[model samples]
Target: MKRYESWGRYPTIRDQKVLTISSRKAPLPLPDDERSVLPYGLGRSYGDSCVNDNNAIIDTSALSNLIAFDPNTGILRAESGVSLATILKVFVPKGWFLPVTPGTKFVTLGGAVANDIHGKNHHRAGTFGRHVSQFGLIRSSGEHLTCSPTSNSDLFRATIGGLGLTGLVTWVEIKLVSIKSPYLDTRTIKFRNLDEFVEVSRENDPVYDYSVSWVDCTTEGDQLGRGLFMAGNFSERRKSRQPKSLSIPFPCQAPSWLLNSYFMRSFNTLYYNKQLSRTVDALTHYEPFFYPLDAILDWNRMYGKRGFFQYQFVVPFDEKGETIKEIFRRITRSKRASFLAVLKTFGDIESPGIMSFPRKGITLALDFPNDGAPTLALMKELDTIVLQAGGSIYPAKDARMSHEAFLASHPRLAEFEPHIDPRFSSSFWRRVRN
Candidate 1:
């Protein structure tokens, strides 16, 4: 038996049976009730959604392969196990880029589809699943399901953002976007409060191709919700530019004291002040802009051996003002440290994924070090605030959300239940399932 854990590095599972499938033709049979199965990608999920503690894990990392590509039309078909990093390496030089990408390039195609992952460009391009044209899935009933907008549509909806509960996705086809250059012309705008962020984001949304912000979650009083906003678009330069090759080499886990409240407050101040000019313009490589944390591998280790929790939630656009301030007020009052706090707006483009997280709203993601009960209590309080505000928490980044909160967040859970493959299950499913 092997061990397994999500990217958060918390709640590690020590007795996992891993099945590695290297090819699509590997006639792998589905698991039965004696042992439920879950398709495991790169295990980049921040929570337990990608893990199955009681059964087996079908490791798809070995199945990475590029099945087909049409450089002229920018449509590519590849195995579900293929990583975004691999795709960028091959296509970026050819002037193509993913229509939507999360904060990390190490995630698998299937995982991206499963979570319906969004990016800074979500306000324009929508989630990753929106660009996926089709895919092939194998279910517990020994049926091969070909899913797309036109074929097996129900299964496709269920599978996307379904958290790998529908079945095992073998391969997928995606529509790539054209890029003039691998660099972006970007601007940074600092905001002092939630109202300023909302106003600035609205003003920049129509003009910029991408937008996001870094909020100071620890700040309170007049400085509450203070942050640095960034907006960018692909540069007109047609020249191909490769991303710089830099990675953190086997860094040791940091001590808990390294990221205490005092340190984080000081860090946020420095980071926010770093952008001296109100709006500085620069040309930057897409790698750093899209995946800044990727430069430091194992950066999660900085949270210490106890690991951390990534709490991400979205409230309707109308609730952008007061609700956000209340959230910040509560966080500041609790004095919990959230080192990485990002805020962004989602466009009105609705995803086909039945359980997809993003919608037309404002999202805030925070990383909090696990301090046991106190942290759980804080999250519960946040959950209440979000639910009351007609918002939803992201399951992909949650490890301790209650069943009531899950049901509240996903009002269509009943409709999605019928599509789940009986033989597929996950720690997250069990925890939140009715």
Candidate 2:
């Protein structure tokens, strides 16, 4: 079997046919002879779900365009290849925003559906799949189909987290939330240790619509897992100016070792304490609050020439989010510290996409600088802790999980496998098909 690589250090790609599609109305390419087709969005997925071995990969970024939007209901209909960045460019200033968004706005509508991404407000709204109304797709049989809750419900659910296995998502209609302003009223808080942060977070979450924390990965012992917490809601600006276009300003990369042992601690110290020294801030645009790290543009370059791995896994709420603490401590003790460790609460979401990865719990995501084999081994062990906690890793953020571990974590594997076209398969699809 040929191997498919990832954005980080994963290597090998031998059997992939890469095709780019444009924004104009064009018929999808497929022959009765082919087994299946996988739609590739912005190629932002960190790993191989969008990749396959010796098979067709239909790139859809060129086909992006806004189709329609219902101003009254805040519902948006757009082609599958259209990106979130394009939506915000036109809508934020117009008083509407995506209900749930990942860190980057570069993802396409079809990509969001395939990954079913969750945002900081996951505790209140769930994942991106929950906010979607319906999507247009081309199945493996060369037939076009539309899936949604009331229509092809199973196929719809299957496609949400289906990893592009059900078919190629061609377009989507989503419901956006209209806001009073394009600003955020943010509150930043700090915790002395991981234990305290988790405790305080649990207390604060019942009331806030959006909440997330950043941890100090370098500290140990009593201060192990210490971090900063930021919570916010839409700013109540009596009147809001139309939001500005996102400017890259200067395109640059994170300084090498920006998150290394020494540098990371100092950075965390300053950021966490900034909360106390600051006052009620004036109105800030939604761009900074909802996507602070994204401002850097291509910030992933910070990991250096070797690249990095973002390990994000959801640990289900067995007893009110306590397992999360154990996982955090394990990760820090292993010494695989990243720049930040994000922990947040998630609400009950109804996605039966056989591979859907969310539940009532807290998620912890950390990055690993690919120093070498040692780092990879450490992350593999960390995967075990997540599995034991009855959790599943986010495929969009994972590039190194083994198929055995994936199936063990998500027992609902069979539901998605049947839809695959046997003749057309991916390294990622083949790995877990057993």
Candidate 3:
């Protein structure tokens, strides 16, 4: 038995059987005996969704391999274990990039599809699953099913954002977007309040391919919601300035005192004011713009040994700007420090993922250091606010959401249960279901 923890490092798991796969021809059949299992990837999920405690997991990291690529059509097929970092190393030099990518590039292709990850460009390109053409799913029933929009359509939709419950994805084919350079024509816009954020998002969403904002949740009153909005697009140049990849090792977790509210408030002020220019335009490398935190290895250690909770939820785009403000107000009143609060808008493009988190709305993500019961209580309050506003919390980043909240957010949950593979399950599934 081996111990494993997801990216968040909360609710640490132990005594689980791990089956590491290194061969493409490895046979994976559903356990004939009465036991549960799930496919495990890069362990990028922030919560327990990827964890199956006391059960078993098939580690797919070593299955990384590029199966094929078509330069003319920009379609690439690779093993499910292939990381986005590997894809960038091999394809970015050839002027191709992923159609949609999350904040980090260390995630596996299978993980991306399972999470149906949305990015800064979600308003334009949709979730990562939208660009996936097909994949080979190995079921415990000894069936290797080819899933796509036109083939095994139900399974395709279910597997995308399905949380790896449908089956084990062995290989996948994705349609990559063509790029002239690995740089972005970036712009930063400063907004004083939540109202201005809505205005700027509305104005920029039509013109820019990407948009995201850093919100200061600590601020209250007139200065509330003050932050910087960043928008960018691929540069027209044929060559991008290659920046050397550097990593900073985090050998140990920081002390809890280091992540307190006072310190976080100061950091928020500095980050928001760091952008002196209300509007600044520059040709920036994609690395800094898309994956700034990736440069720091094991950055999660900064949260301390107790770990942290990443609360992400989306509210309707209608006249619910005040609802969003109320959420921030609640956070400020709680005096809970959330240093990493991000705000973005989701587009109308619906993903085929039955359990996909993104919808046409305004999404807010905040990271709060886990203070045990108090932290969980704060999340519960946030959940009430989201539910009242007719919104939903993201399951990929969730760990302690109530079963009632899950059903409230995902009305389609009843429909999804029928598609779940009986042989596969996870800690998250058990928590929400039981």
Candidate 2 structure quality by residue, lDDT tens digits, 41-62: 7767765666765667777867
**Residue range 1-434, candidate 1, lDDT tens digits:** 32368988877776767777768866565544478889998888998898988688899977788999998888999999999999999998888999899999989998998999999999998988899899999887777778999999999998889999998899989999998899999999999988899889989989999999999987788888999999899999654546557887448888888778888889888998997778899898998999899889878778888999999999986644888788889988887857689999999898999999998889999998999999999999999999999999999999989999999999888889999988888888899874
TM-score of each: 0.97, 0.89, 0.97
Give the C-alpha lDDT of model 2. Answer: 0.73
Question: Can you give the lDDT of residue 278 in candidate 2?
Answer: 28
- What residue pairs clash in candidate 2, if any at all? 15-53, 15-54, 16-54, 23-62, 23-63
Show where candidate 1 strays beyond 4 Å: 1-3, 29-33, 239-243
Off by over 4 Å in 3: 1-3, 29-33
RMSD of each: 1.6, 3.5, 1.5
Model 1 accuracy (lDDT, Cα): 0.88
- For model 2, where is the 10-residue window of minimal lDDT? 1-10
Clash pairs (backbone) in predicted model 1: none
lDDT score, residue 331, model 2? 65
TM-score of candidate 1 relative to the true fold: 0.97
